[model samples]
Target chain A: MQKLGDFKLPQFFNYPPYFTLQPVRETREKQVQLWKELILEYCRTQKIFVIGLEEEFPLFSNPEIERSLSHEAREAFVSALVSDGRAEWLDKGHRKCLILWHRIQDWAEIIINFVKENGLEDSVMTVEEIRSGIESRGTELHGLDRIILMRALKLLEHKGKLAIFKGTTADDEGVKFSI
Target chain B: MKEQLATFRSQLEEFARKHRNDIRKNPAFRSQFHEMCAKVGVDPLASNKGLWAELLGIGDFYYELGVQIVEICLATRPHNGGLINLQELCNLLRQKRKHDREAVSEDDCLRAISKLKVMGSGFEVITAGKKKLVRSVPTELKKDHNEILELAQAQGFVAVDEVERRLSWTLGRAIDALDTLLDEGLAMIDDGHEDGKRRYWFPCVSSISSVGADS
Candidate 1:
């Protein structure tokens, strides 16, 4: 059980083949699936929103085994996640990836629940407050990515459950919840 | 003469039936039985409906083995370039038939491969120095190539200088033959030597014992 900053790694992470991209079709598919699950689980637990390909991501390498995923393998696993709608490439070069462990719809639902629980329905709050506000403390919504927070807010606004308008400050935005 | 022939045929049939299990179990005994049949001007593997085929089913056995040998060769051709070690071929065949009771040996694989030679598709067992390699392609080995392969039998590899000195051939001729062998996958190149001379290794002809001794 290798721990990556309090995130417990699975046993198969030490398997050598898991580092190298398998050439065989069936074996590669299973390896990619395992990597996709591990990456998503790691990101969700650590509240990691984006992964830069060129950066040294801890999940991509194992120092004890001296094994690391090649750039091609990293791209392959990330691409698999993108195809399944669990992740999205933020750039054409695929250098950055935004992982969506919870789909946009699910994120919207979580926002609605947080608003109702905090009695913030029909109340106004800055978009940044939903991410770092005292009401969202200790919840998954706390310290969430501003990009994802805005997307979830837009989804809620489209359904007439909330309204997003420019705030008094240029960089700040406000979200008004009707639920 | 007719009476003697009838008696000999009956005797062979009786011998074959008594040692049917030996033929299947012991490769050396099976080859000796084949030799005896050859000595009598009899072909045991001539047809599946023949006397020996009826008594021991050896003909059909080799036929089935021949099909399997082809499959293994073709399956591994991309990796080894149709030149596979005889022992490796047998190992693969055994693995393929692991659930079956019949055990395949190197001798059995050689026999089955020999049967495949009649098809004229270039299936052959060529000895390089001390290694036995199965060549499934129809590429004709020239005299120069044979000589080089023979020279490689001693040290498991041959350098251009050694080939030139021993065979009294020009550098171009030695390179041409070695290059052909390399292209055919019959030899491997080793450029790791400090002397800056390339050593062409024929895996088929190199004896494992000599390699161990060198190491």
Candidate 2:
């Protein structure tokens, strides 16, 4: 097993074929599936919300074997993720991708549970505060991406479980939980 | 003589009909049959509308094989150009003909490709030492190129110095042949040797196991 910054990588990460894009159809399909799983697992554990295609992403290359995914292979794996709704291309050029380790609906449910457990069901908190708040400490919600948090909050608000309103400053946003 | 020839023809027809299965299944038996046909002044694969063609359909058989060979060569041309090893070509042909009853041999492939020569595409088998390679393109391989390829067969590859020493050719002659082979994609250049000698590898003549290890 290879580890990247405390994130344990799978044994297949060392397999050379995992780095090169396979030309055979069946083999390529299996390779893509494995890459998708590894990418999602790595993102979820490392709290990585976005991946830049051209940037130095740790999971994309292995220095031990001196093998790295080509641009086409990166696009292929990310495209597979996009098709499955596990990831989305944030830029028109597909250079940037937003990985959704947890679906928006699942994130909303997690937020509701967090608020209930913290006794903030009827209380208000700034969007930034919920991300790094003491109440959310030691939880997956802590240090989460603001974009994902807002989407989850908006989902909750649609169900009449919360209300999102901007603070005095245009950049500052706050959420009121009716749960 | 005419009456004897007619009797011999009838006898051959009977022999062919009796051993038709053996001719198709066994390459040695098929070659023996071809020899017997030649001995009796009969050309089994001469034409599609002849008595031999009507009896054994050998002409049609080779014709079908020629079409398949063309297909395989065209399909693999992008990867290996028009030059392919006879064994590799036969393996691919076998894979394509998995459901067919006929077992193809190198002799069969040679015969089929020989038939393809009439189309003016320069289909022929060139011997590199003990190995046989099928060249589908019209590129005429001169004496120097043949010598180098044959010399490279001992090992999977050859250096220019080795070619010069073995063939007693000047450095320029060896380089010209090698450069032509390189440009034609028949040989691959390797510059990673410690002795600073450039190695030219012939993928067609090299054994599969050794190739895997080298790569």
- For model 1, the interface Cα RMSD in angstroms equals 12.8
Listed per model, the TM-scores of chain A against the true chain A are: 0.96, 0.94
Across B7-82, the per-residue lDDT of candidate 1 in tens digits comes to 8877877898999999877888888888777767788887789778888988988999999888877765533446
Off by over 4 Å in 2: A1-179, B194-196, B207-215
**TM per model?**
0.52, 0.56
Clashing pairs in 1: B128-B205, B129-B153, B129-B205, B130-B205, B131-B204, B131-B205
Residue A6 of model 1, lDDT score: 86
Q: Judging by TM-score against the true structure, name the best candidate.
A: 2
> Candidate 1: lDDT of A68?
75
Chain B vs. true chain B: TM-score for each candidate?
Answer: 0.80, 0.87
Q: Considering summed lDDT, which 10 consecutive residues are worst modelled in model 2 chain B?
A: B206-215
lDDT of 2 by residue, B21-74 (tens): 898788889988988888889878878898778878788889999999988777
Where is the poorest 10-residue window by lDDT in model 2 chain A? A22-31
